[model samples]
Target: MHILVDRITEKTGLDPEKVEPAVGIMLNFIAKNSTREEVETLLEAFPAAEGFLAIDEATENKGLFGGLASKMNASVGVLAALNEMTTLGLTVEDIQKVAKETVEYTREKAGPEFTDEIVARVPGLAEIT
Candidate 1:
């Protein structure tokens, strides 16, 4: 849902003053959260985002600020895993195997892209001795 918002914001190229109202209207529909069930029902009727929001305490607490932050963190984790797997010369199956393992292991010092790119540069990286 936030991803869709970013795309819309970019495409419309509207300033915050204009964009915020549109955003409020959209998120309001997605959450459909109100003190009264009838209001929530009316809100859900808008048809803007009935099934998209998978909200919970953490996501709800961020109040629209945390979703993007969470996406960035997820991106970092994925890139880090890619870096480790590539440099280790993990084959497709190896990568598939290590993906679960990578979740158990994360590098705090370096991005995986750095390691993967370096491995690609080494002449013998793809071949084993």
Candidate 2:
């Protein structure tokens, strides 16, 4: 997890502290938007992803308004994830960099076949990463 987080920080120039939660939010969004089989393969390839997912779950809706905001954004997947990432101080470019690095890392850990399958299946994913 540290290795991946370090790699993201090095490449994206984002704060090390922000990388984990950002990645977690992105992964959670991907998992929600993808098929069950795709998610299983993704998780299998990157077991550390579970920890990131937990991070997102833990910090999802905190304040009084956060819960309402989350509910309003629930039907809008990418928008919600984008909101969460921005809340963490990540810019659009930063998010893209993180997503690309994450995808590249996944390709290295898993295989191009596995990574490509997930990307192709998930809408709006290829545009970013």
lDDT winner: 2
- The global Cα lDDT (0 to 1) of model 2 is 0.78
Runs in model 1 lying further than 4 Å from the true structure: 1-11, 14-33, 55-58, 62-129
Give me the runs in candidate 2 sitting further than 4 Å from their true place.
62-75
Candidate 2 vs. true structure, TM-score: 0.84
lDDT of 2 by residue, 15-126 (tens): 9888898888878878877778877888898888888889989988642345553355434556667677788888899989988998898889878998888777666678
Scored by lDDT, model 1 comes in at: 0.33
Per residue, candidate 1 scores C-alpha lDDT tens digits across 1-129 of 444334444554433333333333223321332234433543344333333232222123233333342355433323333333344344444433322222111111123553344334323322221
Please list the C-alpha lDDT of all candidates, in the order they appear: 0.33, 0.78
